[model samples]
Target: MNDSLDHDITAFLDTWTLDPNQTKSCFLDLKAHLDGLDGVRCEFVSRPGITYSLRAAHANQKKRGLFAMVDVIDDDPADRWLSVCFYNELVDDPKDMGDEVPGGLLGEDAKCFDMYESDDALLAYIKERLGAACHSASCE
Candidate 1:
């Protein structure tokens, strides 16, 4: 991440009130995983009162700009949650833990996992999907 992006992300996190369940940690952990990827770049988008999204993509991807989006849903800013989305073709939902959104991802079909509370098991599963998506995107 560049200085500007790092600053922006820090600002977003700073203002976000942590929920009692510690759901914010889930986003932090996922962001750290993305930052560790070999050739990944992430852009942070803030749509205040709607969402604060981290859009991540592999360096080699040509068709789409992003492979996954980690969003902090801000409908209820005081009680925020997460909705991580990925292109359907890039990741497999073997455990059926995500929702099938017909056109949720930039007009393409997407598989999204919603998190309202901190859960190590679910976070681990999502991390696996992120890795899978990064690999698939890199191949493109």
Candidate 2:
């Protein structure tokens, strides 16, 4: 990881208040999956807890790039979970993946999912969605 990403990730871990063990492992696993996706870049976002946003680095125009996000929710500490949120206005939910919750939990036009499994199928699903977001022509 680059210095900025490393620093951001470290900061993210430092702020987590849940089961440090599971939180770290899950976050690492999720990061690994995001790293595997083509043109996708992940960054840490500090809020009530640690969260992340994704973008398409290859997109020539910033407005045409992706703005999907992933969040680590440590609400219960013992039963912490991660959420993958999509900008509903810029992306469609053809698969109806994540639960459509209020934007306060994530951001505007968000579709959030608490991904508890890091299996291949789930990762592929996430990649597909993220890919669509990255390749969107009308991201604005």
Candidate 3:
């Protein structure tokens, strides 16, 4: 995307809210496209448009966390793109949560904030910033 366009998206997402309802909307949209997909979780998470996450359903795959990876494909005949939100990186195993934190409460290990580009031109920029690994993704 052009510099101006990228700026515009950033400006828009700056105020984006990851409301529960919108998260559900994103998840449903992804489901319609991917088959045999499960454990989908979506959220705006301060990112532009609809954003999402989930956990790998294949107990042994080891794509641990709430979001393991994400994918995006062009939507036919539309000004939009479809996003596949896989794994919710926001889930910390009960044993990892803080000393007194409840199993249901999210700990630092479970929170993730990151974004990707569905547009190739902009994607290159993202990849650059992402470097060798997904950017802004960390939990220790």
Candidate 4:
């Protein structure tokens, strides 16, 4: 939310080391990538931060666990790049949790769990880990 913080953070990102700026750059890159996707903002769920994939949502329609939801936490003293991590959801089954999960979210595969700082990396996760999680009933 803080543009100035973003600026400083990005400055740190270019150094090729783990710093607060790396986190900012990562987030900024994400914002830019998601924005360019379909002209719609990548909805961010803060407090317990994460990213939602509208495209995946549309594709799956009735099914969620198709999109990406990155989880951010304050692991460091300053709370920067390393702390802001991402993870996708697995549907396992449509009826497993019903409406609790959002549309297009992916789940059901253990491999889906991974960390990323870029949209591209996140996308790879969807194709790999989350993509494998089947509808909950299948597990039953």
Candidate 5:
């Protein structure tokens, strides 16, 4: 992440009211994982009262601007959840944990995993998917 992008993310996170469900921590974990990936860059997009998203892409990716999107779904400001999405082809869902959304990710079919509470098992699965997506994006 660049300095400006980091600042933006920090600002958004700082102002966000933390939920008891630990969604904030989940988002932070995902962001940290992305930050450790080689050649990966991320940008933060905030649509107050709607959503705050972290869109990430690998340097070698060409088919899409982002390989993954981590969104803080703010439908209910008092209780925010998470929606993590990836291009359908970029990650595998062998465990059938994700929901298939038609054209959900930047107009492309996507596999999305929604998290309402902090679940270690689910978080681990999502992290594995993130690794797979980043690797696939890097090869493109």
Candidate 6:
């Protein structure tokens, strides 16, 4: 993992009041994997929700870049949850990740899911999807 990115992630997690062990372990794990890949930059957006997005250029420069994945944290604590949106252009069923999928997602390409447990299978699945998204691309 890149040091700056690692620091940024830790800082973000620190800002949240939610239990890091309970709600953020999966995301932190995912972030660790993403950090090892090249050109897979992370973008943090604070709006209606705090969203950390992973992005990469597609195989064809003319084509749209892939909005690989995003982890969102809502404003309300009780309503707070981590949501991962995997781009469907390169993934079949992002919502049906190896683990259970969370509710509140509706879109062809915006398939969302939430991870509450540490599942190696799920991480491997995500890595596969990421490879597809970066196929022949400069992602890295």
Considering every candidate listed, which one attains the maximal lDDT?
1
Candidate 6 lDDT score at position 12: 68
Candidate 2 deviation (Cα RMSD): 4.0
Q: Write the per-residue lDDT of candidate 1 for residues 18-89, one digit (tens) a residue.
A: 587688899999999999999999999999999999999999999999999999999987789999999999
Task: Report, for all candidates in order, the number of backbone clashes.
Answer: 0, 1, 13, 25, 0, 0
Candidate 6, residues 1-140: lDDT per residue as tens digits? 45775676667677766654355666666666665666555654445465554444343434444445556465554345556664444446554663333332233345555654455676567666655555534433
TM-score of each: 0.98, 0.65, 0.21, 0.38, 0.97, 0.61
Q: How big is the positional error of residue 115 in model 2, measured in Å on the Cα after superposition?
A: 1.8
Cα lDDT of model 4 overall?
0.35
Better of 3 and 4 by TM-score: 4
Cα shift from native, residue 112, model 2 (Å): 1.6
Q: After superposition, how far is residue 104 of candidate 3 from its true place, in Å?
A: 29
Candidates' C-alpha lDDT: 0.95, 0.59, 0.30, 0.35, 0.93, 0.54
Q: Write the per-residue lDDT of candidate 2 for residues 1-140, one digit (tens) a residue.
A: 56888887787667555563454565576577667656666555555534344333433436534466666665655566667776676457677777777663345557765666445565567667766665662334
By lDDT, is 1 or 6 better? 1
Worst 10 residues of 2 by lDDT: 52-61
Query: Judged by lDDT relative to the true structure, which candidate is superior, 4 or 5?
Result: 5
Instruction: Estimate the TM-score for candidate 3.
Output: 0.21
Candidates arranged by lDDT, highest first: 1, 5, 2, 6, 4, 3
Candidate 3's residue-wise lDDT over 5-56, tens digit each? 3454355334344332233334333333222333333222223334322222
Tell me the deviation in Å of residue 115 in model 5. Answer: 0.5
Per-residue error for 77 in candidate 4, Å, reads 5.0
Model 1: lDDT of residue 6? 99
Distance from true location, Cα of 15 in model 5, Å: 1.5
Clashes counted in candidate 3 amount to: 13
- On the 0 to 100 scale, the lDDT of residue 27 in model 1 is 94
Best by TM-score: 1
